[model samples]
Target: MRDEWNAPWGSIPELVRWAAVRYADTEAVVDCGGRVRVTYAGLGARVERAAAACLAQGVRPGDRVGIWAPNSLDWITAALGAVSAGAVLVPLNTRFKGAEAADVLRRSGARLLFVTGTFLGTSYVASLRRAAGEGDAAGPLPGLPALRAAVVLSEDAPRSFLTWKDFLASGEGVAAEVVRSVRVPGTAASDIVFTSGTTGRPKGALITHAQSLRAYDTWAELAGLRRGDRYLIVNPFFHTFGYKAGVLACLTRGATMIPQPVFGAETALANVAAERVTVLPGPPTLFESLLDHPARRDHDLSSLRLVVTGAAVVPLSLVERLRADLGVETVLTAYGLSEASGFVTMCRRGDPPEVVAATSGRAIPGVEVRVVSPDGTGLPPGSPGEVLVRGFNVMRGYYEDPAATAEVLAPDGWLRTGDVGVLDAAGNLRITDRLKDMYIVGGFNAYPAEIERLLAAHPDVAEVAVVGVPDPRLGETGKAYVVRRPGSSLTADDLIAWSRREMANFKVPRWVEFVPDLPRNATGKVVKGDLREASGP
Candidate 1:
């Protein structure tokens, strides 16, 4: 495995091609809903065909291709193909609304977009078109000046869009030589992942292919992901957890990628038992749901060997329960962000439940992690301060936004994670608090700045401040303290309903409190500490 890791591979396509030859007959992907299975050899061919299709569409090297869809065979194929065609892949969060997706599409200047017509009872194409408007009357979708085409992954494509089948069929005209010629370098940008920014907008994080492959290679090794292992990926494909750790990791390890689009406990249990899945990685809530479900024992989960979970705090009892109740041998905890290719500190096997529960584990090989004071000096072990990371895993920069990139990323390569943590003598890191106000809801990052910006647009809202309060189910949910406009009769429920229409569900404040005015510091900044205290424990 070490020798294989040292081999020279330049890009995603090269990795796929090598995997095809090395693990030709090995199962690569299994679409649970479509009941489709593809081998390594077949998956490689599909990626190449998708690349040819992209070339036929006149997509040039370095072009941005946006994929706005949920996890599926088509999603993976489209993403891999675009990257193979030397185009930078831009993945849109499935949780995003039409306006949100359109904003990213416009900012990225994506020439082509692949969208799911419908998923989980919502029509994405229809919603985006509605947001973008119809025909010449709309005047080029407001901000999306470069968006020329969209391919809908459905039976019928929307107006001015191509169907999935037709999009692939367009490749028939492009010669294989054209696809082969568009070779992207390993150090070049592979994917531009947009994460919620502190400035109320999403910033694109440019990650290279070599960094991605290297980061996940160490990750797979630490997680005990082995050849022939059936990996049930419940994590969203948009995030690095699913795309890099789930899809790319499978290609490197010859594991079977069984993508579970939406996570439901009953469905997950049945799939684990039926498919004889050996590995399952998701947030702690997933395992909690599985354990709390009544029919958990009904499924034969004896094949389950590895479980990797992080993001939210993993209760000590949950870690113990996962082993005692389910017989999962190698349950590990990890920590990372989208900027780091989702590779950072990870707990090793055989660690005690207390250590696993309290700390995020030690840093992965080649990554440097430090707890630093406000002065940028490294703090002593056990002293809580900001967590700073510098390594091969850190992204090149936020795409096309050098000013915003300069704020968080240092010239010395240290990335200010905005997370506060303490390192033990053993080098295990225990996250104490966050320097930033960002919070996680069901493993998804919900930035207060982004949510507050949306809420501030409300006609009834005069002033607003958002904070993260503890929640048993989702780990943490947003609580908004709002000062309403004069004589406005807006109820908490009313504001919630209005927010639902304006923003993504995760970003919506679950709780609303009407206040005369927010408690402010001398600098005229809202004191979130006071609001958090007022909201109560």
Candidate 2:
């Protein structure tokens, strides 16, 4: 284990101190909804207060605190607060139903939960209560023995749940100072980030703080993130891409962050113009939506100095359109996963247009990437193989899953990325496909196996297989082929509706086909490659 003094700013609180010293009065975070602005100093104080509150609740070092909220000021505050309190922050997807959300909360062993009362039209508190096995009329979560308390983010405080204002108010005066001094030894960059797996289970990738900060610093240095530069964050905070690239990077570099709760292309464009955002990074879908918007012509995006797209394979045409129509000088492509603390490979700022469009760029500083065959042998350039990365940015291992960790992280510390890619002579990475049946829908990982498992649970379904099909808008959408049981008459609409109820909205299959039997290979494996190809464009 690395010494705390030698560690690269071991906690988010440390990073906050750095930013506060440099840009104390600058607007650190801006929410356009209520036009709420939090200056660096003010943000630091709130973080300290929240941290104190966590400590008051007996949250010690390495304790898991679940953050089940949407993209908001409170979400960021709670995340930083947990880190400051020396607790491992576990961010839950807001789209999850009660059962799904509870599973993550229970599995993570979260002692406290911070959730919004409501987001958009969804009631998060209601969902969480139901998931906790406390039905609508029930008081507190029934089975969450580990959960000490629930803090609701609302103007009006609930009877059973503690309100955000009251929670923050609990950490006043000298208590905040004591919380600030409480430091843990092992709170390095290598912590766990629970990402959804193809098998419907969430795997906690152990990414170190060093790896995360390296990604932030590398991108900041390469992208020229100067002080006073504003960034527009529309990407959800749960994903590593958004957390590391969007939030941490900005916080580390003294850049202002303008967060949008939900993504609306027109609203994003307006915010960009309003905030004079200099650096913007999101999935290609966001940019595509912006380009397709009729109002884009009227919006002024000239302030954007750098535009980055990653998480999914970016279309070359989209790259061309941004440069041609939007006048974006620096268009970059990045490639990484939850295990690598966001991005390990990214195109440099001044690279030639073709190179930027074709590759995931060179490995960032201190990171080593190699393309290797299935037998663990190194492959020559241009030969596609599993991309293995070993670096400061590589995760320590999966949390508490030694067998799963050993399978991916070799004896030599190389982390098998499970992504099929080829390294060019210049070491640029071009991804082919994922080794696991994982597909990206609008930059979010949608595991076909997970969706298939959910679809099979439907009463009318006998068996089902889900595969990714080409989608112009989302990049890829799930298409399921089902074999109904004897005497069962289930239509595609029925399966779709069932999926919408059983799983998150994004995991629902866009198209469903009834087939007598699924094509299988000689080895008795369902041939998804054939299904995807046969589905057609």
Best-performing candidate as measured by TM-score: 1
84-196: candidate 2 lDDT, tens digit per residue: 88888788776677777888778877888898887868788777766675522333576676787778877764556778888877666437568869765443532467775
Candidate 1 segments exceeding 4 Å error:
1-5, 135-143
Clashing pairs in 1: none
Give TM-scores for every candidate, taking all chains together and pairing residue i with residue i: 0.97, 0.95
The number of clashing residue pairs in model 1 is 0
**Cα-based lDDT at residue 19, candidate 2:** 73
The segments of candidate 2 whose C-alpha lies over 4 angstroms from its true place after superposition are 1-8, 135-139, 157-159, 185-191
Query: Candidate 2, 459: how far from true, in Å?
Result: 1.2
